[model samples]
Target chain A: MAKRLMPLLNRVLVEKIVPPAKTHAGILLPETSNKLDSGKVLAVGPGLRDKTGNHIPVAVKEGDTVLLPEYGGTTVKLGEKEYHLYRDEDIMGTLHD
Target chain B: MAKRLMPLLNRVLVEKIVPPAKTHAGILLPETSNKLDSGKVLAVGPGLRDKTGNHIPVAVKEGDTVLLPEYGGTTVKLGEKEYHLYRDEDIMGTLHD
Candidate 1:
């Protein structure tokens, strides 16, 4: 978001939503990288071609919270932070408030 | 083409098109597995859900020749043959007759 790094052709750009620190049941919580499944959508591709060669728009839009797969993505760096490029389909699901 | 391995929700099943052996310039060609990019589509997902909750329909259909990525796929075994499961977006392109 601070930098421009757009994904192409059914691909989506996302940054993993690292968990916040907390304490629960007298235990320090979120010490581990859990919920790697969650990420913030950054940029998206212009959609891939369809049978008739028309674009079949990507499902998620920028600023949307999305579910990410544990594996599979092309890591990229911008400024100082890292982002990932995942095919829109590889994104497992979308999160809503 | 011999198994029932329907890929789920934007997934596509494919078997790499291994090049046939041949001789060229007194050298045996296709011995090193070049053009692994080509594949035969076996089965495809019924498409993934969209923002509206309707299926967005997979781009490629069964029996289409497709281009495969160098990596990133779940290997599957059926009988004596091995197949691959790729998200439809991971498929780079489709080959036509």
Candidate 2:
């Protein structure tokens, strides 16, 4: 499981949320639309230290859903699943529910 | 100047440093190699707030030479020059020079 992948220094490990299967006029929609800009937090990095050497924790936690940019992030492939590693600040925002 | 491009929320504006020109056997090399992995900080965003609402400042400062990843970051084009905006945590490390 990519959940074992621990990000270092204010990074977050996320698994992109898969969009629900959809059909248009009884025909399946293109797979391209399956890519979503949201994900579930899998793992988080030890927060990075500030100039004063104080540790600043990430805003989001494991199990939290977050908004991801269309680009950026380090891709991690574990078995058949894909995960992404993003700096804490790379996450645009967190989604409730 | 991209220096005027202000980044928000723990983002940084960086001007990529041009690699030293190299010539081999008097043949000018391709410009592709000029794309460097390092840059100088031009501007910085107000630090992001932690879960507790405390602001965490970025580690580096303007004029600081920083290491940048080959991928990621938002590209901003100003005139004929190209700049990149990266989150504070996206900066890999600081280079002393």
Candidate 3:
């Protein structure tokens, strides 16, 4: 049996997208240029209940690329991979193209 | 014109209640003994709107004694008094007795 990560109550599970290690010219890129501020949404919660007990869905969905804040978001390590769990509101915005 | 403090969006205006400087035994208390965790609610917001646009009023009301968290809550100054503005949920609970 395998365990799958499932976000709960408007939480989002994201995998940090690390920038490419080198340029197309075969030159090593500086670590400073590799700002790990973007992530790919791996899973999303089933939305939170409002005051009236109505469900309000999160804005972003799975497979979306999102901008992350410099701080916050709980880091979770599963097996050999590391993922971040953030409240839906903590995600800055979704990236297009 | 005299200005008044009015909280908005389910926020509460609280005035910290500092403990008495001296004990009943006529001994002065140390600063460490004063936790400063209690407050008196002075004003409350009209309530925030839920997803369905329904108003969700704050639980605490004026003159209520509330327990506060050690951190968080924005400091507000009006006239010669200092107050704290906190969201309804940020207030730990209402103190009874």
Alpha-carbon lDDT, every model:
0.72, 0.73, 0.75
- As for candidate 1, its clashing pairs are none
Task: Calculate each model's fnat, 2 decimals.
Answer: 0.02, 0.00, 0.11
Residue-wise lDDT of candidate 1 within A1-97, one digit each (tens)?
4578767799999998764465445545535434235678888999976665556788788997875666899889898988889998777555444
* Residue-wise C-alpha lDDT for candidate 3, range B1-97, written one tens digit per residue: 3458899888999998886677789888665652326778999999878777776667678998875656789998787778999887666445544
Q: Where does model 2 exceed 4 Å of error?
A: A1-3, A23-36, B1-97
TM-score: which is higher, 2 or 3? Answer: 3
The residue pairs in collision within model 3 are none
lDDT of 3 by residue, A1-97 (tens): 0124555557788999987789899899887973448999988866666777676898899999999988887665443367777788989999898
Q: Using TM-score as the measure, what is the rank order of every candidate, best first?
A: 3, 1, 2
Better of 1 and 2 by TM-score: 1
Candidate 1's docking class is incorrect
Q: In candidate 2, what are the lDDT values of residues A1-97, reduced to their tens digit?
A: 4336778888899998765455445656456542326778988988877666667777678998775766789899988888899987667555443
Summed backbone clashes in each candidate are 0, 0, 0
